[model samples]
Target: MELLSALFLVILTFLVVTAFYHKHLMAEIPPGFIQRKKLCFYHYLLNFGFVLAKTSEKLGLASEIHVIRTIMNTVPPLKDKHLFIKDVRFEKIKVRIYQPKIPTTGQRRGVLYFHGGVGQFGSIRAYERTCCYYARKSDSVIVSVGYRLAPEYPYPTQFEDCLAATIHFMRTAEDYGVDPTRVITCGDSSGGTLAAAVAQAMVNRKDLPKLRAQILIYPFLQAVDFNLPSYQQNKTFPILTREQILLLGLKYLNKDVTLLNVLFEGAHIPEDFQLKYQKWLSPDNIPEEFKPRGYKPGKIIHPLSDELHALTMPTFDPVFSPLIAEDTVIAQLPEAFILTCEFDVLRDDGLLYKKRLEDHGIRVTWCHLEQGFHGIVFLAPLGRIVSFQSGNKGIKQIIDFLKSI
Candidate 1:
C-alpha cells in the first residue's frame, strides 16, 4: 500500500510538471484563428504527449520520435465502403495505395502522396484516412509513400526513396488502372518539399511519363531566408512555429541542433549566394496585401563561417529549395496547385514558388487560407473535435483542382 501511494505521487508530480512546462511554452492562439477553442485543446493535448515523449527519452525508456510515432500511428485505419486500400512496395519502399470502389469508364488520375512530419515521424498508417478521402473524393488512385525517415535513413535517402517509388509507380501505373500520363505528385509540409523536389527532378527526364500537375500544401521551400513576411507574422503560431521547423529540419538533415539560432539569424547563407538568389527569394516578390500583418526587411547580422556554410550548404541546393530551381527546369514542369495558410511560416514559400512558376510561364493555381493553420488538412479527417471548416475548404479546393485537370 505504501509503495502504491509513492508511485501515485510520482505520477502526479510528473503530470503537474508537464502541464506547467507546456503552459510556459505554449503560444497564444490568435483571436481570428479557426476554431480557437478546439485548437487550444488539440495543442495542449499534443504538447502533453510531446512532454511525455521527451521524458521517456530522458529516462531511456524509448526515443522521443518512437513515442510520438506510436501515438500518431495509433489512429485506427478508416474503413470506407467506397474505397479499396492495400499495402504494397514500390522499389522495396513501403506504400499504401487507395483506390475507389466504383467503376470508371477509363483510367483514373494517379496521385503519389507523401505525408508530412518533417521527414521524421509521419507514416503511411498515420495518413490512411487522408489518402482514402482523396481517393474517394477525387475519384483517383492515391499512393502514400512510406519513405525511410531520418536519424536512421538520413539526408537524401528520403528524397531518393520518394523519387524511386514515384518512378516505379509511373512504370506500373497501368497495372493499377491508373493513367501514367495523368499521374500527380502531392504532399504537405516536408512531404510538400519532397513533392516539389520530385517534380523538379523529373522535369528533365525523357523516359518517364510527364506528370500532369504537382500539389504542394504549405511546403517549406527555402532555407536561405526564414524572415519572410509570413515567418514574421506567424512565428509564434501553433501547429508549427519557425523554431520548430528549423529544429526539425536539422534533425532531418542530421545536423547539430545548436546551429539553429545562427540559421534563424540568416548567417548560414553566403553573401554572394544570397545576392544571386535575391531576385527570386526577396520579400518584394510577395504581394503587398500579405504584408498587412507587418514585415521588415532583414539583413544578415553575422558573416557566414566557412564551417557553418559547409555544414549547412545542402539546404541551399535546388533539390532541397525548389524555389531556387533554374528557369529552364521550372518552365518545363507541369501545372502546379500550391496552398498556403495565413498562420503558417511557410506561406511565403508557396507564394514565392508560385511567382517563380508564373515568371517561367508555368500554369499555377494558388490557394491561401486566411484563417487556416499548418497541418489543418491532415487534422480535418481525424474527427470532429479537432476539425476546422477551413481545413475542409482547403481539401475541397485541392479536390476541385484535381477534377478540373
Candidate 2:
C-alpha cells in the first residue's frame, strides 16, 4: 500500500510539472500569428481536462486542473497596474476585490462577477484571467465571487452564496470607492444564471439599491424546456452535448436520474405551464437571422403524467428559471447587457430573456458572436497560440459595454 501510494504521488507530480511547462511555453508564443483555431480546440479540451484531473482521484481519469491552476495563477496579481486587488470577507463569503489602481475623480461602477462552472466545477483560479481583464479594461471595481459547487452542497447553496456576496458588496460599495447606484451583476453560463436571478430578486428591495444592470453571457436560465432551437441545433455539437447537458442538470439538482427521458422530452412540464412559458421559451421567439444556420421548430408533444411532471417540476422553479419571475418583478429590474453565441445550446435562453426584458420596457444591450460556440469566451486568449478574432471581438464587446455603463 505504501509503495502504491508513493507511485501515485510521483505520477501526480509529473503531470502537474509537465502541464505547467506546456502552459509556460504556450504563454511565450506571440498572439494573432499563433495557430489560434487549433489552440481553440486545445483550450476546449483543457477546460474539461481540468475537471478530469481533479476528479481523477474518484473517477481515475487524469489531472489537467493542476496544470491550469499553476499557469492561470502564474501572473501574480498586478497590484501596480490599473486594479487594486484585495481579499475581503462579507456576510461570511470570501471575495477578491478589483478596484482601479489609478485615482478616480468620483466613485466608479462596481461589477459583481460570478464565474461559470455548471455549479459542479470551476473556481476563481479558472476565471482569474477574465476577472483581471475586466478590472483593467472597464476601470470598474470588480468583485469576483467564488461560490460553492454542487454534488457537494446541493441546490440553493451556490445561489445563496452569490446573493449574499452581491448584496453585501452593493450595500458597502462606498467602502471600496465604488458608487452603489451604478452596481451591476455579470456572469457567464451558470454564473449568468446567478446574475439574472440576483437581479430579479433584488429589483424591488427598497432596503438596498437597485442593480444598474445585468450582463448575461449565454446564461442557462431554465432547465424546463431543453428543446429550444439552439439546444436542438447544437445538441450533438462539440463542447456541450445534449445528453451531457441533461447529465449536468441532474447532477446540479441532485435529483434522481432514473427518469431522465421524461425531463428531456419536456414531460415534467404541465400543459398549462408549457402553454404559458411557450410564448417565451419556444423557438418561434428566435429571430430569423439565427435560422440562417438551419433551425427547425420542434413539434409540440402531449403532456406527461402528473407523477412524471411532478418529479421534474423543479426546472421551472424561479431559482432555475428566472424568466418565470413575476412580470412585476421583471419590470422593476434594471437595464441589461446580453451576449449570445450562435453555436451555443443556451442561445435561445438568452434570446427569450432579452425579449422579456425588452417587453417590459427595460434597456438591453445585445451582442451576438456569429461563429462562436459554447465556452468559446474562455478560450479567447488563454495562451499565445489559440486566441481567435471572434473570441477577442466578443470579449471586447463585453468590456465596451461595461465602460459604457
Candidate 3:
C-alpha cells in the first residue's frame, strides 16, 4: 500500500510539472497588463483538472470530464449577510432570488443574472457569491437563473429555461418589491449570450415589462467567424481557449466532437450564408487599435460542406448569435452595457456588438478591461491570491452603469 501511494504521488507530481510547463510555454497570452498571480491560479486549476480526470478513471467513473466537473461544481455555503436569499422555481426552471434586507421607500431595481460555464457548467449555487455581491452592493433584487445545462438537456433548452424564468420574474416582480420597469438582464461568457438573447426575446413581448437595459460581459455573441483577430491573438489564453470554445458549443448542441475541426475552419457555414453574416461579423467592424495584436484575416475554407452546415444550422439563428440579428431587431433593443477583455477570444464579440448597438441608435455604456482576461469577474472576489484588479474594476463598472440607469 505504501508503494502504491508513492506511485500515485509521483504520477501527480509529473502531471503538475508538465501541465505547468505547457501553460507557461505553449499558451499564447496576449501582451497587456497580465497578472502573474491570476495566471498562476489558472495554471494550477488546469493541472488540478487533469489530475482529477485521471483519478476519476482509476475510480471507474463513467466520464473523467464529468467527474472533474462534478467535483468543481460543489457549491459553497450561502452568504446572506445583507439579503434574504431563497431558492425557488419559476415555472419549470430553478432560480435563486436575492432581495436586500434593508428597507426601501419604493420598489427596488431588478437584475436577472445568468452565470457562465459554456452551457454545460455553472449554476446559481456556484455563482452565489457574484449574485449576492450584486444584490447587496447594487441594492437591487437579483435573480440568478439556474438554467438547465447541455449534453443532458440539449440545445435551446438553456435559452428556453432562461426566457421562461425571466418572463416569470418580470410578471411577478411586484410581489418581490422589484420595479418591473427598471429591470436589467445581465450575464458573463455564455451566460452573456443568454442574457442578450433573452433581452432581445423580451423586446417583442407585448405583455411583458420592457427590460431597461442588457449587460453582456465578454459574451460569445456569434459562431460565424471564430477566426476573428481576438481568436487569432488569444487562441490559447487560459480559462477558455479557442478550441475549447468550439468544443463546448458542440457539446451544448449535442453534436459529435469530431465536427470541432470542421467548425473551427469555418467550413460549417456556406458561402451565401457567410456573406449574409459578414456585414455584421466582419473584422473590418473591429476598431483599428484592436488590430495591432497578431491578427491575420483567415481565408474562408473552400467547398463548404452541406452536411456540416446542416448540422450547425441552429447556430446561425439570431437566437444563438444575437450579434447577427437584423437592424430592425437591434434598433428595438434596450440600452446596453458591454464589457470586453483584452486577453479574451470573445473580446471582438463585445466590441462588434457595441458598434452594432450604437449604429442602431441605442444607448450604450462600454467598459474595456485592457488588463483583464476571460473569467476575471468571478476571480476578483476570490481573495488576493486568486483575484485580478481588472475583475474588481469591471464589476464596479457594471454596478455604476446599473446605478446610472
Candidate 4:
C-alpha cells in the first residue's frame, strides 16, 4: 500500500509536469498569449510556491525553454554601468568586449566567453550580468563572443568564429592588459560546449600559449545517445528537453525536418557507430547511484536509417563534442572547473566528461547541485523569482577554482 501510494504520487506529478510543458510547447507561443505576459512571469516565479500551498505537495517544475526565455525578456533590464559596447570586426569575425576601468599589475587573464543558447537564439545580452560580475569579481578582461547562430549561420561557422576570436585575443593579449600565458576559455550551456571545443582546438595549436583553465558550466557534450540516464530521467525538464534538443540538432545542421521521426528512434546513428561510441555515451558509463530518482536504458534500434545519418555527422566531430577528443589531447588540457545540476538533461554529459578528464590525469574540481534545474545560473535575485542557491554557489565554485590556479 505504501509503495502504491508513492507510485501514484510520482504518476500524478509527472502528469502535471507534462501538461504544463505541453501548454507552452507548441513550436512557438502565439502573440495572443502576450496579453497575459505579466501574469505568466508571476505564475512561473511563484509556481513552486503555488503548488506547495495548493496541493500540500511540491509540484515538479515545468521545462518551458521559450517560456522562461520570454519571461526573462519581459523583466526590465537591471541597471548596469555604462558599457562602451562595440562590435570589433577582427579579421572577418566579430567580438564584443566588456571592461571595467581598473588597471592590473602584470597582465591579467583574458576570458574568451562564449554565450549559450543551444547555438541559436542567444547573444551577449543573455549573459550580460555574468560578464559584468566576472569583470568586477576577478578584475579580468572579458570578451563575449556573439558567435554565429544555427539556422542563421549553421554548423562549423560558430565554432570557427569562436576559435578565431580566441586566437586573435591570445595574439593581442598585451594590448588589453592580459597575460598570454594566463588566459582562460569559458562558457555556459551551449557556450560551455563551445568553450570546451575551443579549448581542445587550442591544445593542437602550438602557436598559442597553454590555457590556464577551462570552466564549463553544465555544457551539453554529446549527441550520440539522447537516451542516457540524465536524458530519460530529466526528459521533460524545463529550459531544455529531449524533444527540443532534437529540434536544436536539426536547426544547427540545417537538416531536413522530415527525418525527425527516424532521428528520434535512435536511427540517426548507425549500428556500428553506436556500438563503437556506446562506451562513452552509454547509461552504463553513468554510475548506478544517479539512477535513484529514475533511469532505464532505452530499447536498442538494430537498423538505423541512412537519410537520418547525414547532417548528424557533425554531432560527433571533435569540434562539437570535445569530450570525444583523443586521450592525448584531453591529458594536456588545463585543470577543469565543472558544474552540473541534478535536474538537467545534460548532467550526464558533464559527469562523463569529468570521468574522462580524471582518467587522463587532469585535475577536476566538480560542483554538483542535487536539487537545481538547468538555467538557474541566469536567474540570480530578480524579484519574485528566487535565485537557485546552487547557481550562485556554482559560480563561486568556479571562481574559487580559478583563484586556486
Candidate 5:
C-alpha cells in the first residue's frame, strides 16, 4: 500500500509538470485560430505524447521516432467495404494502394500520394483514411507512397523513393486498372516537396506518359529565406513552428542541428546563388493581401561563411528546393494545384511557386485556406471530434480538382 501511494505521487507530480508546460504552449496559439477548444485538446495530446516519447528515449526503452511512429500508426486499418486496400512494394519501396469497389465504365485516374512527416516519421498507416477517402470520393486509384525516411535513409533517398515509386506506378498503372495518361502526383508538406520534384524530373522523361497534374499542400519549397510574411505571422502557430521546421529539415539532411541558427538567419545561402534565385524567391513575388498579417524585408545580418555554405549546399539543389528550378523546367511541368493555409509558415512558398508557374505560362489552381493551418487536412480523416470544417473543405477542394482533371 505504501509503494502504491509513492508511485501515485510520482505520476501526479509528472502530470502537474506536464500541464504547466502545456499551458505555456497554449499561450502561443493565435487569437483567430479555428476551433480553439479542439486545437487545445489536440495540442495537449501531441505535447503529452512527445514528452512521453522523449522520456522513453532517455530511458533507452525506445527511440523517440519509433515511439511517435508507433503511436501515430496505431489507428486500426479501416474496414471500409467501399474500397479495396492493399500494401505492396514498388521497386523496393513500400506503398499502400486504395481503389474503389464500385465498377467503373472507363479507366480510373491514378494518384500517387506521398505522406508528410518532414521526411522523418509519417507512414501510409497514419494516412490510411486520407487515401481511402480520396479513392472513394474521386473514383480514382490512389497510391500512398511509404517512402524511406531520414536518419535511416538519409537525404535524397526519400525523393528517390518517391520518384522511383511514381515511375513504377506509371509503368504498371494499367495492371491496376488505372489510366496511365491521366496519372497525378500529389502530397502534403514534405510529401509536397517530393511531388514537385518528381513532376519536374518527369518533364524530361520522353518515355513515360506526362503527369496530368501535381498537387502540393502547404509544401516547404525553399530554404532560402525564412522571414517571409507568412513565416513571421505564423512562426509560433501550433502544429509547425519556424524553429521546428529548421530543426527537422536539418535532421532530415543528416546535418548538425546546431546549424539551425545559421540556416534560419539566411547565412547558409551563397551570395551568387541568392542573386540568381532572387527573382523567383523574392518577397516582392508575394501578393499584397498576404502581407496584411505583417512582413518586412529581411536585412542580411551576415555574409555566407564558406563552411556553412558548404554544409547547406544540398538545400540549393532543385531536387530539394523545387521553387528554385529553372524557368524552362517550370514551363514544361504539368498543370499544378497548390494549396496554401493562411496561418502556415510555408504559405509564401506555395504562393511564390504559383506565381512562378503562372509566369512560365503553366496553369495553376491555387487554394488559399484563410482559417486553416498546417497539417489540417490530415485531421479530416480522424472523425468529427478531431477534424475541422476547414480541413474537410480543403479535402473537398482537392477532390474537386482531381475530378476536373
Candidate 6:
C-alpha cells in the first residue's frame, strides 16, 4: 500500500509541474520564433530550472537564480588540437590564454575577452569554447579574463579585475607573440560592458599599447532607463527577461530587489539626468525597423527616494555605463565591431551605441542577426540542439571582421 501511494504521488507531482509549465511559459513565446520541437523543449527545461532556482532562493537555500542559471550553463572544455591553452594569473585575477599551435609569420593579433554573467557568474572555464573558436578561426591569441564575480566582490571589482588583466596582457603581449598594436578587446552581454568600459578607460593611458578595436556582442550598456523599446518588446522573452535583467543588476550591485519595479518605472533616475542622456539613449536613436514588433515611449518619473538615488548612481558613471560617455570619449574610442540580435532586450543598447560611434566619426561594422536572440553567439556550433543557425552566421561575421582589422 505504501509503495502504491508513493507511485501515485510521483505521477501527480509530474502532472502538476507539466500543467504549470504549459500554462505560464508555453504561452509567452514571441512571434516568429523557430518552432522546432527541440527549441521548445530547451526553453521549457530552462524555465523549469529557473523555477527551481527561484524556489531555492526564496527558501534561502542558495544564491541568486541569475548566478545559478549561469552556473548551470557551464560545460567541460572541448579538446582543440590547433590551440595551445594555458591558465595564468595576472596580479590576483585568473585568465585563460589560447594560442594557435600552427606556425605564423610573425606576432598574431591578441584578443582580450571578458565573459558575461552580469558580473556575477561566468568563469574562464565557461568561456573556453568561445575563446578557442576565436583563437582557432581568427588565428589570434585569446586571453579570457576570469574576473571576480559579484555578491562577494560587488561593483567595480569586476571592472578592476578586467582592467588589470587587460593592462597586463597589453604590456606583456610580446612574450605571448602578440602584436601590441593589434590587440583588441572583445566581450558579450555584461562582458561586452566590461570590454567597452575597459577600452574607454585605456584611451588616455600612454604606457600601454593602443587597442586596435572593440567588439561588443549584445552588451547591456546602460541601466539608467530600462523602459527602452527592446526592454518592452522582450520583457517576457526567454533566457533573459525584463525581470531577470533587473534581478541580475540588483545582484551585481548587492542591492535590494524591491527596486526592480521602481527602476522599471524609471523612478531611480532624476528627470534632469534623463533629459541629458536622452540624446543617445532615446527610442528615436533606434531604427524604425526594430520597432515594428512593439515599443511605447517612456514618460519621465519623478525622483522617488534619495536612498535609491545613491544606490543606483554608479550606473551613471562612464566606467559603469559606457553608452553615456561624453562625445569626446566616443570620438577617441577604437574602431568598433558591434553585433545586435533582433529579439534581444539589450538590442537597442547596441543600436544607440552604433549611432553614437558613427556621430563621432568612428568606423563601425554593425551586424544584425534577425533570427538570433541574446546569448545565441555562445551557442555557435555546439549543436543544433543548443545552437541556432543564426549563431554560426554571427560567428562568421565576427571572424570576417577580425580578418579585416
Q: Which has the greatest TM-score?
A: 5
lDDT of 2 by residue, 351-378 (tens): 9999988998999999888766667777
Candidate 1 CA-lDDT value: 0.89
lDDT of 5 by residue, 1-405 (tens): 999999999999988987786687678776777587777777778867888899999999999888989998986668679998898999799998998999989899999999898898999988898899889889999999999987788889999999999999999999999999999999999999999999999999989999999999999999888988988988888788899899888888888999887876788877788789889888899988889776777865567677877899988888889999988899999999999998799999999999999998889998898888899999887789778989888999999999998
Q: Candidate 1 has what TM-score?
A: 0.94
Candidate 3 lDDT by residue in tens digits, 106-221: 99999999999878877777788888888888889999998988767887888999999999998999999999998899999999999999988888899987899999999999
- The TM-score measured for candidate 2 stands at 0.84
Q: Cα deviation in Å at residue 66, candidate 6?
A: 10
As for lDDT, the candidate ahead, 2 or 3, is 3
Candidate 2 Cα outliers beyond 4 Å, as residue runs: 1-40, 43-80, 381-384
Residue 275's lDDT in candidate 4:
77
Clashing residue pairs, backbone N/CA/C < 3 A, model 6: none
Runs in model 4 lying further than 4 Å from the true structure? 1-87, 381-386
lDDT string, candidate 6, 1-405, tens digits: 999999999999998987786667656666567744445566677666767777878888885545464655567676899999998898898888999999999989999999988987878877788889999999999999989877678798999998999899888999999999999999999999999999899988898777899999999898888988889998887678889888888878877899888888888888778889989888888889888777888887885578878888877888778999988788889999999988788998999999999999999999999887888898884656678888889989999999887
Better of 1 and 3 by lDDT: 1
Per-model CA lDDT versus the true structure? 0.89, 0.77, 0.85, 0.73, 0.89, 0.86
TM-score of candidate 3 relative to the true fold: 0.93
Instruction: Give lDDT tens digits, candidate 1, residues 1-405.
Output: 999999999999988976675565444666566477667667777877888999999999999999999999988888889988888888689998898989999999999999998888999999998998889989999999999988788888889999999999999999999999999999999999999999999988889889999999999899889899999988877778889899888888888999898888898888898888999998999999999886888887657678888999889887778889878888899999999999899999999999999988889999888888899989877777667989988999999999987
Flag the better candidate by lDDT, 1 or 6. Answer: 1
lDDT of 4: 0.73
